[model samples]
Target: MSRRIIACEVFKPYLDKLLEESGVEAVDYLEIRQHDHPELLARSIQSIIDETKDVDEILLFYGLCGNAILPLVSKGIPIKVLRVHDCAAALMGSNAAYRKRFEGNPHKRYHCLSYGERDDEYFARTSPEYRKISEEYGEDNADYVFSMLYDKFSTPVTYIKLGLDGEESQIRRKEEGYYSVIEGDLGLLRRMLKGDDDHVCVTLHPHEKFVGIYDYEEILTTVNRNHDREKTREE
Candidate 1:
């Protein structure tokens, strides 16, 4: 069956690596930009679905980002989504690992990496939408909006490494309040891309609509099993 992936642009670097490593060919992608404006991504996803009528399954390199993927799934081709709340989980390598690190307030912390944001070029600051918000709501209100949008990476933040290389790693290391880099595994991504489906993927058949992430038990179960296997291998 032909497979396609509709991935967030933020996942580019990791996706590139996984594709090279997995050696799975015949995958296509619709790159959606990060940020909370779900409508744009929703539209992009729909456009791809319309264009790729021959695809047997669609894998989304997305989380249940602010209900962005909620409206995209339907009764047509099967859609596969990672069992994650956001891309941070993907970088952490699993939802369980992501939860363990940012246990207190999952939404308030940002996982800084080159693929997401390490050089501080946050999306909201430079996006055209930010300028539009400033014009419509005034600079004061715009800052407020930006703050709320990226409140996770707020002041006095600690950085954890998600395995992205280069200066971002160094900056994260020397900076105060920064935690040691926690290495992340790419096994889940590689499995999903290859249609392995051992765990960590929630497949929605055609004619079914995604209600919420409560439907992701199978995925988590699989990831947990994978984790166990990895531990055994290490031992």
Candidate 2:
């Protein structure tokens, strides 16, 4: 069956490499800026899905993503979503793997290639909330607010290397403060692309909606329309 991929732009570089190697095209990348508002992110994805035609299936390169994927509903075409909390977990290959590393270390920030490339200003500039704060409260207050919201935790950053050549040097050079590097496995993504529905993906069939369980294991599931209707009738 013909397939298309809807992925976050943050994964573009890595997905580009994978698509090139696999010779699979037909992918759409959405802006990372939408991540500032999960609701908007979900709407943007639904818009893309609404516009998609001729594709038998859509492969989403995303995680629960602050529940952004939770509202997505499949119509005629089925959607396969990566089963993880976010891109960081996807890079680590699984939710369990990510939890093993950082479950207890909640203060540590996880950095990847895309995250490493952007500076603090880039994030602040991209965030609409930050812009509003800056406009209303002034730049200094905005900085303080964001720093309190995002930079309160003090710990060495953990950089995940996705096995790309020259990535280590680039990340090491850009990352400030103490940091550690760990090899990231793309095996889960490879499996997803290969259509191996073993455990790394949750497939939403036509009329089914995605649901986030808010846990490390069983990260997401699909709610069938029939089941929802039954529940509504019972209620």
Candidate 3:
């Protein structure tokens, strides 16, 4: 079957390596900044799905991502998506693994190669909504504003190393704010690429709409469009 991958750009390095080894070249990497607006991110992905032609299946390398993928509909082609809360959980291998590390620490921040390398740039681009506050109040005040907004005081930062080159040193050089490192597993991603529709993935057949679930064990599921519409109306 002809398959294509539509993934977040943050997974580019790992996916690049995997795709090269597997000789799978049909992939579209979307900007990580789109994540700042869940609705816009969903629309962007839907546009890509609408534009793709002759592909029997699309592998989506994403988590529910604040429900960004919740509104996505399969336009004839089937879509397979990872069943994790976000990229951090996907990198950790599963939601259970992620919860083991961060179940009670809601204020903790997650850092991976992509996030660590572009820390400043990521914040600057993803938080354009705070630009006016920064401009009007100056940077120091902006920092305070952000801290208040996110409750970031003494927030622990966990960096997950997927054995990528230069990742260790980069973690060491990162400004120390309760920072630590842990090994990450890419097994789930590898399975996804290999078309394993196991527990870590949710597959949506043609015309099915993706939906987010509150339970971490289940993560996500799909429903028929008409059923989803009626459910929404009932709510």
Q: On residues 166-189, what C-alpha lDDT tens digit does candidate 1 reach at each position?
A: 536455454565434457777667
Candidate 2 local lDDT, 1-235, one digit each (tens): 7898999987877887888899969678898768779999999999988888898899999889999988888877888999998988888888888999977888878777777665344545567778888999999998998787667766477888887765767765754765678888888888888885849899998878877788888988888768878998999
Comparing candidate 2 with candidate 3, which one achieves the higher TM-score?
A: 2
Ranking by TM-score: 2, 3, 1
The global C-alpha lDDT for each of the candidates, from Candidate 1 onward, is: 0.63, 0.82, 0.81
**Residue pairs with clashing backbones, model 1:** 75-206, 75-207, 76-206, 108-152, 199-222, 200-219
- Per-candidate TM vs. native? 0.71, 0.88, 0.87
Off by over 4 Å in 1: 24-35, 74-76, 114-119, 123-139, 150-160, 167-175, 178-180, 213-235
For model 3, how does the per-residue alpha-carbon lDDT over 1-235 read when each residue is reduced to its tens digit? 7888999987887888788888858678898878879999999998998888898888899889989998888878888899898999888887889989877887777878887765645354246646767788887787777766444634557888898886878876756764677888988888888896668789888767777786878888888878957978999
